[model samples]
Target: MVGRLDGKVAMITGAASGIGLGTVELFVAEGAKVVAADIQDEKGAMLEKRFPGKVVYAHCDVTKEADIEAAVKKAKTEFGGLDILFNNAGISDRMSTITEITAEGWSWIFDILVRGPALGMKHTAPLML
Candidate 1:
């Protein structure tokens, strides 16, 4: 059967676990190639082994531009091009009060939730079009 995402290529951040990992599995099942990006080295490698030609693992920290850049490049190189950039990596401050939110904490959240997605777009947009 032809899958919904047949021939599409996706790069998924935070992909070693949680929703990101779920997306990676679904995308592959749907016939999309995926780059699983995360700091979890073992999980990432395992996914690559499990999915074989359908998935490649790229070590990525959303807070780091170099890592994000590397992921984009990996998608392009390994799969021929990028069709999706799934910006799913994020952080939160569940226990911190507003006053307890230090500048570093704020930056960490913003870097992962906002700037990382933006960076993903910035780096991948050109190739996507």
Candidate 2:
């Protein structure tokens, strides 16, 4: 039988590891081409190699607008279109209590978890539609 996501294209952030990586694997298994974006260069390369043509890895630091835009472009170039975007990139001071987290830590978390996804949506909207 044909897969549910057959012929779809997906761009996923935080895809070098964890849930994001899992998403890439599942999407590909379901017949979608996936663009995996993450700052973990070594891990990202490994992911690209693991799936060969089905997966492309983009070195994306979600807090940076340029990286996010480049990721969208990479997806379009690699697959010719985008049908889905999974803004899975996020960070937090999990080692410390909220009250004990430093200001810089708060800023980092907010940038990655909030601003990143918002900018992702803005830049990738055209391609997704």
Candidate 3:
């Protein structure tokens, strides 16, 4: 029997660790070519080594549109096309109270959690379709 993702190409942000890493593992196991993008270069490189030819890693700080754009371009160049995009890059502040959340803290969280995903989607949506 063939895997559900056989021959498909997928791009997953935040893929150097946690949920994103799990998704990348499963996608590759199911026979999809995967592009794993994260800001963590060392971890991403380790993941790429683990998966061999089935996976590629892009060092991307998702808060920047140019970085996200480069990741998408890498995906297309490496895998030929993109079929799935997992917008999973995010950061958490876990502030105890509104007063505890500094302006800079809020800005950082929003930049990572909201703007990052938005930029990834904006750059990758057209490529996926």
Best by TM-score: 1
lDDT of 3 by residue, 59-112 (tens): 899878889889899988998978888988876546447778788888878888
Q: Which stretch of 10 consecutive residues in model 3 shows the poorest summed lDDT? A: 90-99
What is the TM-score (0 to 1) of candidate 2? 0.93
| 1-129 per-residue lDDT for model 1 (tens digits) | 999999999999999999999999899999999999999999999999999999999999988899989998998889999998899986553537888889987777788889989998998898888
Clashes of 3: 0
Candidate 2, residue 103: the lDDT equals 89
Best of the two (1, 2) by TM-score? 1
lDDT of 3: 0.88
Q: Against the correct fold, how does model 3 do in TM-score?
A: 0.92
Which residue pairs come into collision in candidate 2?
none
* lDDT at position 7, candidate 1: 98
Model 3 regions more than 4 Å off: 93-97
TM-score of each: 0.94, 0.93, 0.92
